[model samples]
Target: MSDNSRLLRRLFDERVRDLGLTAAQARLLLSLDHFPDQNQCFHADRLEIEPITLTRIADRMEEAGWLERRSDPADRRARILHLTGKSRDIVDKLQSTVEHLFEDTLRGLSATERDTLGKLLDRIGENLARAREQEPVHG
Candidate 1:
């Protein structure tokens, strides 16, 4: 699964190369699209990356006019990420690129196979989530 993920990511990177985004950046942008107005800490957790790392990536995206960080109303210390007009404009293109990539990747699979794969992946995700929830708390 890890090998397949890496290969898919590589293919996605190649497809989006002309759009001037790395797979990480594209992932960040897409994640924000799905779950908006989240703080850096939240995004870092969702992306499974260090807060400092997300900060650095956000810094670049901010400079590029793709997104902005605003002080959260509930917590001034926390900065919520928001997509900019520039990013919103290109989001469709990004999504379409992803769809195309998936189409290519799953080209050989039958519809039933695709449905089964999706369900299995969802089950795995749910199992992982349950495992995380059951982990012992540490100080």
Candidate 2:
């Protein structure tokens, strides 16, 4: 599964190379699209990334005009994320590129096989989630 994920990410990175976004950056943009107006901390938690890392990515994207950071009205110390028109314009293309990649990746798989694979992957994800939940938290 890990190998497959790496391959898929590689393919995605290749496809979006002309768009000037790394796979991780594209994913961050997509996630922010879904949950707009959330602060950097919110995005870092959602992406399971270090806050400083997300902040750096946000900084680059902001400079590129792909996104903007706005002061949160409720929390002056917090900055909310918002996608810019530049990113919005390319989102559909990005999504289509991923869809095409999936189609190519699963070209030989039958519907039943795809369904089984999806179910198995879901179960594995749930198992991992459970294991993580059982781990002790460190400050």
User: Which lDDT tens digits does candidate 2 get at residues 1-139?
Assistant: 7899889988888988877788768888888878888999999998889999999999998999999999999999999999998888788888788789989999999999999988998999999999999999999
Estimate the TM-score of every prediction. Answer: 0.89, 0.87
Measured on C-alpha atoms, candidate 2 has an lDDT of 0.89
Q: Per-residue lDDT of 1-139 in model 1, one digit per residue for the tens?
A: 9999999978888878778888778889998999998899998999899999999999999999999999999999999999998998677789999999989989999999999999999999999999999999999
Report the Cα RMSD per candidate: 1.8, 1.9
Q: Per-model C-alpha lDDT, please?
A: 0.91, 0.89
lDDT value, residue 8 of candidate 1: 92
What are the runs in model 2 whose C-alpha is more than 4 Å off? Answer: 137-139
Ten residues in a row with the worst lDDT in model 1? 15-24
User: Which lDDT value does model 1 have at 116?
Assistant: 99
